[model samples]
Target: MPTNGWDTHMHVTDPSYPEAADAEYTPGQHNLSDALSFESTIGINSLVLIQPSIYGNDNTLLLNALTKLGTRHGRGVVGFDTDATSFETLQAWHQLGVRGVRLNIKSNEVNLTEAELQERVTRYAKIIQPLDWVLELYIGMEDIPKLEPVVADLGVRLSIAHFGAPTLPPIGNRTLPLDPYTVAGFQSLVNLLKAGKTYIKFSGAYRFDKDPQYRGIEGIARELLKFAGDRIIFASDWPHTRFEGLDIHPFVEKCLDWTDAAGVTEKVFSRNAHELWDIPLDK
Candidate 1:
């Protein structure tokens, strides 16, 4: 790990068992104390706690964990309904060290429509812009095309989840699907990076590859890194959802190997996180 490194992405489940299945995945169980141990082993000095979808908009558990972890070791990314979360409430979260908001559109659990989606995105942009917080998208790659125009229209900085959600085998072939809309979305990400309006997290290789070892995903990551290495950041996606069988450290090590440092590893591992999330470090 780079000196004073921070893991830009992580999640902690709620402490209470509102639902038995959800409770199993709680941060108190999978992260919290466990994360400190993992950080020690990995040499990451700081971390960001993203609110897991299991908790929906109730960020109390995540916030509690952040409070316990303390500012020196933690920051947060919360989830909220743009229609429901008022500006004052958002400002409070910002003061609590929340540097970003997560738009978990992929799960479809929240069930938003095109109009509602656009409205929420706009509202979030309006609220977070003054604080300079980012909007993080966790959705399918195909869906990105539908969402790009709104993001561009809003003039807010955005982060696409999982490396532009590249289409590879078991999803789409290596060449990427030829759908014009998808093509436009992928190009939109490149354009956004070129214009310095967006960023991508080089995380969750397990989510992209059908193979457990993540053999071919590196090509997609390199493609993004080629265009926006400085803007790209790395993440462990700790307690990887549905991928508990694999060792997290080895996956992280493989990602490090795939990138080959190329002089960009430092940025991916630490520097970009500092710039994007305002993570404090000794350097």
Candidate 2:
């Protein structure tokens, strides 16, 4: 394990804080204490506590956790209405360790037309431009190719979460063990990675490959590692929503495989996160 590591994606849920009225999932009590304790054992010094969809824009839980973690020590990817929200509030959040905004189109399963998708991300890109923050985009596998033009001129830091695909319902017919290689717009996403237009977060292995070892979809991960490793970022995705009680070590070890080279692991785990969060390693 690297002496300093960053788990770039994870959620912390509290039973006391209710889920949104339209919440699709009522998560269990995955508290901050347990998450931090587990992370400590794994040599992870920093965290990117992402805002879960259950809470919608109510990031009280995430901000509260950041209060405990201290600024710069803990970072977040939160959700908010870019239009209704003011830039001052965003700057306040930045002071509290929020480095980006998460545009979670995947959770609501909303399909946007090319014009609509472009409008949405473009608006967000413009909103966060001044902050120099990254946009954590989550969209359907089919919506990715549409992003080619969006990123070509976005001129902002952004990342595609959960490998940016495999949110696809099913490839052809088979469901559970979907091969990420077959994900719609898979090649276009790779091209974006190669062009350094956006970053692809390699997490959520259990989403596609049901096998604990993720053997079925190893090919897809390997292909990205081979071609776009420079833009790849590994995240533990701890307390993996809907995929609980799973050992993160195995998934982290899988990342180790993808990041076998000395320089590769350093970039994927620690260095890349620093660049993304704009936080110093010792912070």
Candidate 3:
């Protein structure tokens, strides 16, 4: 393992904190101590606690965890209402180790027009540009193409979650007919990676491939590694809200197999995300 390995994406759910009224999923309690313990067990030095969608724009739990966990060992990616949030609050969150804002379009069907979605991300990009932060997205597999130009033109770092959430083909073929939106989105994601305009998180293998060994998912990982190995980062996706009772070790090991190059896991697990978020490495 690299000395400063980081789990770049994960969530913390506390029952006491209460989920948003409109939350699509009712998450059971998963808190700061549990997260810290998991990281320790994995021998990782730092972690990035992403604000779960259950909390909506209220990031009290995430900020409190960052404060308690200390900035050196923790970072946060929070959700906010760009329309109502002030720059001062954004700067304050930045001071507390928040380096990115999440735009989770896949959580629920937002019923928004493409123009509305574009306007929303554009506003967020403008707000965070000064802080040099990333816009972390959990968009649907098909929406990637629609949002590609907005993210590219916004001039801020963009990180796509869940291996770009590729639309899977039928088993055995490795290549098959794909829906127009899926094909377009996957191709756009590849083009963006080639241009060094975006980054991908090699996390949530279970989301893409349900096999215990994560067999079929490797094809997508291989493609990503082939295109932008340097831009891919690893995350445990711990406390895997929708998918718990799944051991992370196997998934963690799967991250290393994405590329055959020596020390590739070291780069994806430690260097890529640390550099992207400007986390200080242990000497």
Q: Write the per-residue lDDT of candidate 2 for residues 50-120, one digit (tens) a residue.
A: 99988999999999998888865689889999768888999999899998999888877777889998898
User: Between candidates 1 and 2, which one is better according to lDDT?
Assistant: 2
Residue-wise C-alpha lDDT for candidate 3, range 83-194, written one tens digit per residue:
7899999999999999999988777767557788888889889999999999998876667767766766897888899887765654564442223234437787887788
Candidate 3 TM-score versus the reference: 0.91
CA lDDT, every model vs. true structure? 0.72, 0.80, 0.80
Which residue pairs in model 1 clash with each other?
13-27
What is the C-alpha lDDT profile of model 1 across 144-244, one tens digit per residue? 55665577777578876677666555643544322323332566666667777678887787776776656556665656777688788887887676565
**TM-score to native of every candidate shown:** 0.85, 0.91, 0.91
Model 3 weakest 10-residue run by lDDT: 175-184
Q: What clash count goes with each model?
A: 1, 0, 0
lDDT (Cα) of model 1: 0.72
- Candidate 1's C-alpha runs over 4 A off are 19-28, 109-116, 171-185, 281-283
**Candidate 2 root-mean-square deviation in Å:** 2.8
- Model 2 earns a TM-score of 0.91
Evaluate model 3: give its lDDT. 0.80
Instruction: Report the error of model 2 at residue 204, Å.
Output: 0.7
